[model samples]
Target: VLSFGLAGAASQLLGDMAHRLIPVTDREAASLVRSIRTAPLLFGWRGSTPVDTPALEELLLRVSRLVDDHPEVVAVTLEPVVVAPHGVSVLGA
Candidate 1:
């Protein structure tokens, strides 16, 4: 699953979640990242520096690989991930 929302929004908020089988592909993961409703924020909305969206996409792929490698891992969540111009910070797992 790929899930996210505006910085302070709730988990179950509408349009903030997606699901897929294990071993999620690059294309699939990219789609999920693009589906973010607040994606404009990642692209330098209002003159702010754009977050490194490609880096965020890489993180999603890594999470997919983790689950594919470990069947025991049913879910993964990263909360309050601060996306910066150059990278992202996973504040909570």
Candidate 2:
């Protein structure tokens, strides 16, 4: 379950992102993706295939649960999360 502590606007240039506190729900996870300006890339841009949004949502939810289960975890950052039609891969965490 890879995730991050709030999405950034990608060097503050690409676009904006949505955020919520820990314990995010599935609905919120979906909304987070939608709120991102570059969300279309995830849905399939150009001739690219769309990634599994449900898997992304599940990963977000699981990360939220981890935060809720632990008290010492103050921040988490998983950069370059590669998502494809087949699966997702965390490039760095």
Candidate 3:
């Protein structure tokens, strides 16, 4: 699972947060982090199943926007994005 801790002053999105960079040092990391915001991934890629990157992106975007807006949130730890053949599920938020 990819985990991170953010340390900064108070801030707010106060607007459309469906598209924004997550807490990251650079754009590449932001892209990677945003990709897995949907569900956890099982131990399968080739023949197992595919994960919903879009759904995860939305979830991550919302969460990231919230965190960005609210300064009170010092940090957050989320479970890895889990993907199932039937659907995707995020263990923790």
Q: What is the TM-score of each candidate against the true structure?
A: 0.80, 0.80, 0.47
Candidate 1, residues 8-92, lDDT tens digits: the string is: 4553555465566657788877777667666677788899888888888788889888887888998787876887888888999
Ranking by lDDT: 1, 2, 3
**Residue range 1-93, candidate 2, lDDT tens digits:** 323332455725653656877778788888887776677777887978888888878778877888789968877776767767877777887
Model 3: pairs clashing at backbone N, Cα or C within 3 Å: 12-69, 38-56, 39-81, 39-82, 40-81, 40-82, 40-83, 41-81, 41-82
Pairs that collide, model 2 = none
Task: Tell me how far the alpha carbon of residue 51 in candidate 1 is from the true structure, in angstroms, after superposition.
Answer: 0.2
In order, how many clashes per candidate? Answer: 0, 0, 9
- Quote the lDDT for 30 in model 3: 47
For model 3, how does the per-residue alpha-carbon lDDT over 32-65 read when each residue is reduced to its tens digit? 5444323123224456665555554455555666
Candidate 2: residue 13 Cα off by (Å): 1.0
Task: Output the better candidate (1/3) by lDDT.
Answer: 1
Instruction: Give me the displacement of residue 6 in model 3, in angstroms.
Output: 19
The worst-scoring run of ten residues by lDDT in candidate 1 lies at: 2-11
Give me candidate 3's TM-score against the actual structure. Answer: 0.47
